[model samples]
Target: MFTLSSEDNTNFTELLKAVHKIGSKTIAKHAQDVDQKARFPVESFAAIKSLNLMSAYVPVKLGGMGLNVEQISKICEVLALYCGSTAMIYSMHKIQVACIVHHCMQVDYFKNYVKKLVSEQRLIASATTEIGTGGDLLSSFCAVKESDGQFTLTKKAPVISYGEAADDLMLTARRNIDAPNSDQVGILLTKEQFQLEPISGWDTLGFRGTCSSGFIVTASASIAQVNPVPFSEILSQTMHPFAHITWASLWSGICTDAIDNARKFVKNSVRRNPDMPPISSIRLAEVTGSLNNMRNNISASIKEYTEMLIIGDSDAFTNFGFSTRINNLKISSSQMLIDIVGKAMMICGISSYRNDSELSLCRHIRDAYGASLMVNNDRILMHNATLVVMHKEAR
Candidate 1:
């Protein structure tokens, strides 16, 4: 059994140390090349799995670490700083494991799966987002009907991470075949039992190495288990927090990366040209402070939300609180990093844009654009907030 090293201290610190020791050293350096070639970071994944970090959140009774969400978020934040693609892959796996641990009816199967994942260093990811559905899992147009206790999931999931590499995929589909527009749905686990013909390639401007490809599910497979309730409720209640924290951590890591690169550029410029303007020094301080503030806010929010989850108060509404906060943080971090990177580019002049500088703020900018598009976008979140305030006023 993997015992978490931190008994009295915050688990986040320990998680950071573990990732550092697990050989995530060249993740950032390799990120550009991987993104350029659209190749998966196989070495990084292998290193993470070898350290059993992939099974960090599975219950210890199941021969896993059983760490909490706060710990997992810390590890994710660290990984994101190095490689956004690797961080995303790991986050999806963690979300799937958390869902199974909390909702699976077959306890034996769940335990055995965790054991196998830990022992064999296997990974799982989500294939829930559909191309036509517009990234909303609750409002998926994908249909799954019950015919002799077997469910067939048919949908075109675009931008699914690790589409061909995942050991299993947590897929969501609507059960209301008679009513195609109804929100009644359930989650089903599909093992490596289907084909993943890449319908669309993943040559994106950012997060390129994520291997987020579009594929179609053509065959009917055995349904592992269903939530026994509406899928929307399960997603809003159980899955939202996982998504929020994971993505928030990723953005936070990217913010750190931007800051580090900016600092290096400024420091080198100052070293070479000692007579540089004081404004450059002031701008560097401002950007560094902004990045630090965003990182602290995200880390604190993850800790608070994790406590709520562990205490069993993770209902849809309560979970939304953390979700909204994370969303806000994502937006703020992206904007800040973009401005900081732009300033850094000016400081470094044409050299920053050169291929040899290895300073690709372009990828970060694109990935940041996609971040705001995740789940509830800015307008939707604002509307939700308005509804809440109006409800409180009526009360």
Candidate 2:
């Protein structure tokens, strides 16, 4: 129900209000159960599907809401206020939608597919990481074999979040048998076209509702399923920035909720004393400051990325400077979630540590840890080290 500004579009503001209603009334109710069971947030997703937001990033001409990354990122942030797993699933889904809409929509088949996606409210998942690749998203050990206008691929993915629940899977593989591991193409395969043989379970400390299990994904589809855009271009232009920004937005939401609880704890202690403010209030102030900085950092990155896209600054997206900033945003925001939540736990004391307490941060703290491991901060830092050396200038 919150509008970013008075200048925001009236219709989208109403849409966001509707999303907030769903988040508070539906998603939050089932979040605990979903986490406890280590299962997908089916109830949360059903509410989301009711809004027909799956194609939010698709063009309006393609029969979607035609939302940009900023608006979609806001939605992710709002959803995370209620449930991190649901928010993360939605964020990942939108990232895949952006990939297809921005890169593959030039092809008629994918164009129609987006339209169909809008109509059906289909969910999409990605298989970008392979078992042998060691979490390197750009490399692929599997190849798409093409013959007689049909192509087939089999991948050993270490993790495919909600693969069983998705209506479609967008996977990466070498363009052909002769192509190198890095010469990859994204292939869109429907549920009917792919079979996932589970290779690992989803038991985890947090984000359990994501069901990010390992799988052997075997798929066959028309050769037309191969996207026209290069995988590297999609990776740099859409995947990297979108993933980092939306993810940071969601993590910000989680941190905000945790801080809100800390505020409540401090307020209660102050009410009990009635003479002087509790020392925990100082900790609350510190965490709130960090939260504000985290939010501002994410907002600045969002603004920069949005402006670059508006001006058709294609090179900036792939440039070392922007890439480094985006990577830093991910690193800082991920760490801040832990820092803010840990501080909240310290401020709230036993209440925040207890699973049954109203101010419990157990779920929030566990979920915050997953942010650092999503793509591994150390790997990104290593890449950034090389990027800084190559670029040699900061904006």
Candidate 3:
């Protein structure tokens, strides 16, 4: 039986060592350029490809290294330390991949695709939100058109991160033209199965390497490509909590960089003054404490999620209390990420304000701001508000 646990992470230590090697040298080198140009971090992706980490989280039965959520979250955090865009891109890919492993593997097509990952470094992207839906992922304006085991769909996606560049895209669509907006299915589409027409620009505050521009996604696939289960059930079981853990891992990574810079600045300030501690030292201490909490909360979520996976707790996936906790995890981590990055900038003072300075957080701050708005925490908070009253309190 496959199991994921913090206690079992020793299995992937060497793999992580390899990831760190590439990160410190290659991924770290391109962080500034990737952000400045607002282009895809080709080098980071290449490093991931070279190391074959695209399959790192994939199971050994499928020719992958088969690391679990706890180990994979560590990889996401480590990548964020070098480049937030790279980390975000990696986290999103893993979330999609997790769906295949945890839910879709019973389908022969998804299982074969996993085996193919060993030889083909295919990148996966997701399209869950459509422009016509008013930010509601549960509804879809794009309905799947099907005839004789053939299916096709088109959607004006508000954003498709790394869309044009992805080798495969997993999308959601109404089950059929006549089906209700909420009757949806998830489909696995290869590049040959789809065409993308650019719709909007991607110049943004941060996460530029993601290349998350708007586009018209037209895709066609066979029935085998469609998930055998309902999209809503799959989202609840796999995508939601998986996204939270991976995304929050990256946020913790960004916070790790911020606190490191803040501490370095304070240590230097104390050395220079020799007699008095800097006024900002107190804030540094406070933020450091908060950062610890932030990391702990994220880690605990990953662990809880891992345990949930281990037991194959299908009922737990739909439980309101579990869903609320998962939703709140994303909200809290995103907001705290901005707060920590801002404080780091204050600690670095004038230097961090300047983009050219050694201690500058110009990129970090921009990337941090993108976290809360990525999935929109306000929307999540609103959803939780509707559920909080009904969510049973934990024993």
RMSD of each: 4.0, 3.2, 1.9
Can you list the residue pairs that collide in candidate 3?
A: none
lDDT of 1 by residue, 1-395 (tens): 01123333345466577787653565665777777788888878877886788778777666667777777787888888777788877887888777766665354545556677778877776777778765556667777766886766677787678777777766776664765544645454545555676788887777777788888864365544555556565565456666766777777777767667767777776788888754567777876777677767677767666555555553533444445665566566556655655665565556656766666566665666666555546665674675556444223
Which residue pairs clash within candidate 2? none
Best-performing candidate as measured by lDDT: 2
Regions more than 4 Å wrong, model 3: 1-11
Which residue runs of candidate 2 sit more than 4 Å off their true CA positions?
A: 1-8
**Model 2, residue 18: C-alpha shift (Å):** 1.4
Query: Compared with the true structure, what per-residue lDDT tens digits does model 3 show for residues 113-143?
Result: 8877678978999999999798887899898
- TM-scores for candidates 1 onward, in order: 0.84, 0.96, 0.95
**Which regions of candidate 1 are displaced past 4 Å?**
1-15, 21-26, 105-108, 176-191, 272-277, 314-323, 358-362, 374-376, 382-395
User: How many clashes in each structure?
Assistant: 0, 0, 0
TM-score of 1: 0.84
C-alpha lDDT of candidate 2 relative to the true structure: 0.90
The candidate scoring highest on TM-score is 2
Per-model CA lDDT versus the true structure: 0.67, 0.90, 0.87
